[model samples]
Target: MKLAVLATGNIANKVTQTLVQIKELECYAVASRELSKAQQFKERFGFKKAYGSYEEMVCDPEVELVYITSPHSHHFEHMKLCIEHGKNVICEKAFTVNAAQAREIKSLAQEHKVFVTEAIWTRYMPSRSIINKVLSDGLIGDVKAITANLCYNVCHRNRVSNPTLAGGALLDVGVYCINFALMHLGSDIREIHSTWQKIDTGVDGMNTISIQYNDGRLANLTSAITAKSDRQGIVYGTKGYMVITNINNPSLIRVFDYDDKLIKSVEVPPQISGYEYEFIESVKAIGEGRIESWSMPLTDSIEVMTIMDQIRAQWGLRYPME
Candidate 1:
């Protein structure tokens, strides 16, 4: 699989480092608004080519897959550009600024017969399926509720404070907590109640969201950009509960019995920054002539974005681009 990256940002750098570790994948090209940055990124990552303009990079016939690591506000535009050029895409999370944009991109990808997927890395991790199997096997008995927290002191970052960039703790980190709950608890969100504290820029700085599923399961999730959190996710059940150390990239999973005794512990396999799984899945999907990854389908992406739209509406938050 020949892969090209659309941005030379921090996330793209980390992803490039992981891409080099995969023997089957090649870092073919990288692009940025500035040629110097793209050249630096290319030299550092050993990419075959670099482009100052994204349009030029997407037009390369050899670049089969393009990873859009740009800001959330630019995802829809960048993704549509790649799809229009007959290139598959793996876009970073907060798939777009809103659910409406996500639907448009999905429709475009289907019409062009191009593979496009959200790079919500957790959905493609092997630990996710293992945890699902544990729950299905009744190790934790009947599930009742789930609680997840993902917070970081990243308010100083421009992307987290600028409304034009669709900056917010909800779209950046809260998406992980929501994905954690939805991946394990199911996505039949019946009721949603949320409250948030907004920064002066009108983006959410801290938020508390409660989601009730159709099956009576509830998820309590919290995210913040002003403070640090444990980033833990717990699934409570009739018998006991399971603890996931990190919701973003789960490294350890511990299961406890009714007496709170540790009954099982699973260590995730060694990873190359945990980003390779999603890239590998995308390659496989495209190889099979699929327009979307089964692990993180377009429907799931739209569902998550819809939930975020509802939360933002309740908080009276709207980005400038919207």
Candidate 2:
């Protein structure tokens, strides 16, 4: 599969390194607004070609898949470009600025018969199923609550502080906490409440969200771009609790009883930066002529975005793009 990356940013660099490690996918092309930056990325990642603009890259006949690593606010526009060109897309998380844009792109992809999916990565990781199995096997007994926190000191970055770019902790990292809760606790949310602190840019800098599911389960989630956190996710149950060391890229899962006694620890399978799974899955879906990955379906993406929209609405926060 020939993969074209849409940006020359840090994430594009990281994901490209992992793409080269996969035998089936080729880092065929890269694109940036400036030709020189694209050329630099091409040389650094050994891409077969580099284009000065995304328009040029997507027009390539050999580019079957376009991985969009652009900013959150630009995802809708970039994805539309790819789908319009009849190219499959693997868009980064926070799929769009809002649920409206998400629905539009989803409809466009289906109309074009192009395989478009969100690159939420965690949904495709091996740890997802491993944790599911542990829960289903009665090891954790009856699941009740979930707690996840993901934070980093990223306020210094322009993309993290600019509302025009959909800058915020919720869309950037808080989405992971929401994804974590939905993945394990299910999304039949009964009630939602949150408190958020905004930065000078008018985007959320820190947020604490609480969700109540129809099953009476509760989730306490927090995300911040102004500070650092332990980045842990815990699934609490009647009998025991499971701890996921890093909700973003789970490397280890630990289980403990109500007495706080250690029960078991499981290490995730070795990975090539933990991004190969999503790309591999996207390639497989495209090969099978599927418009979405079974793991991270378009509906799931829409649901997650809708949840974020509701959260933002509650906080009276709206991005400039929206």
Candidate 3:
């Protein structure tokens, strides 16, 4: 798989580094609006090619996959360019600014017979897989409830408080909370109630989402840029509970039986920030002629976006040109 990453920023760097780690995939090139940035990245990552424009990179037949690592507001445009050019895409989340944009991209990708997914690396990580196995084994019995807290002291990232950029904790940091709940509990987000701490840009500096399911299962999920919470999550059930420490990054998962007895802690590590898994998955799915990923389908991405959109609407958070 030959992959070209759009935007030579932080995430683009991560994507390229991870792509190189895959045995079959090559980080063919990197492109950014700034030509110097792309050139610098090529030297730093050893990618053979670099482009100042995404369109120019996508036109190359050698590029089998295109990773859109642009800003949240620019995902739709970047994805459209890649899909229209007949390139598969691994997009960064909030997939798009809203669910409506996600729908548009999905339709285009399907019509083109191309694969597309929110390059939400965490969902495709080994830690998530390990936990899935534990849950399927009934180690936690029937999942009764879930609590996730993801708050960090991102004082340097004013994007959370920048209205012009749609920088909020919900889209940037909180997306993981929503994805974790949806993965463990399934795609049924019946109702969501969210409250936020106001940022300088009138967006949420910190927000907590309460998701209720049909089976009386509820998840208390929270995301913030104000201060660090436990940065951990718990899935509880009648039989046992699973504890996920350092939920935001790659880490270990510990399962406990009743009376808070430790069942086991799976030590799955040596993963590079866990972002590499999603890119590799996209390559496999596309190679198999699949239009969507079974692990995290386009519909699943839209469902998560729908929940995020509703949460934003309830909090009076609106992004520009959305």
lDDT of each: 0.93, 0.94, 0.84
* Comparing 2 and 3 on TM-score, the stronger one: 2
TM-score of each: 0.99, 0.99, 0.95
Q: What lDDT tens digits, residue by residue, belong to model 3 across residues 22-75?
A: 876887888889888999998898888989888789888898888888788889
Pairing residues by index, what is the TM-score of model 1? Answer: 0.99
Which residue pairs in candidate 3 have backbone atoms (N, alpha carbon, C) closer than 3 angstroms, thus clashing?
none
lDDT per residue, candidate 2, 1-322, as tens digits? 9999999898898888899899879889999999999999999989999999999998899999999999999999999999999999999998999999999999999899999999999999999989988998888899999999999999989987789999899999999999999999888999999999989889999999999999899999999999999999999999999999999999999999989998989999989899999999999989999999989999899999999999999999998666
- Could you tell me the lDDT of residue 77 within candidate 2? 98
Cα-based RMSD of the predictions, in order?
0.8, 0.8, 1.5
Q: Weakest 10 consecutive residues, lDDT, candidate 2?
A: 313-322
Off by over 4 Å in 1: none
Off by over 4 Å in 2: none
What residue pairs are clashing in model 2? none
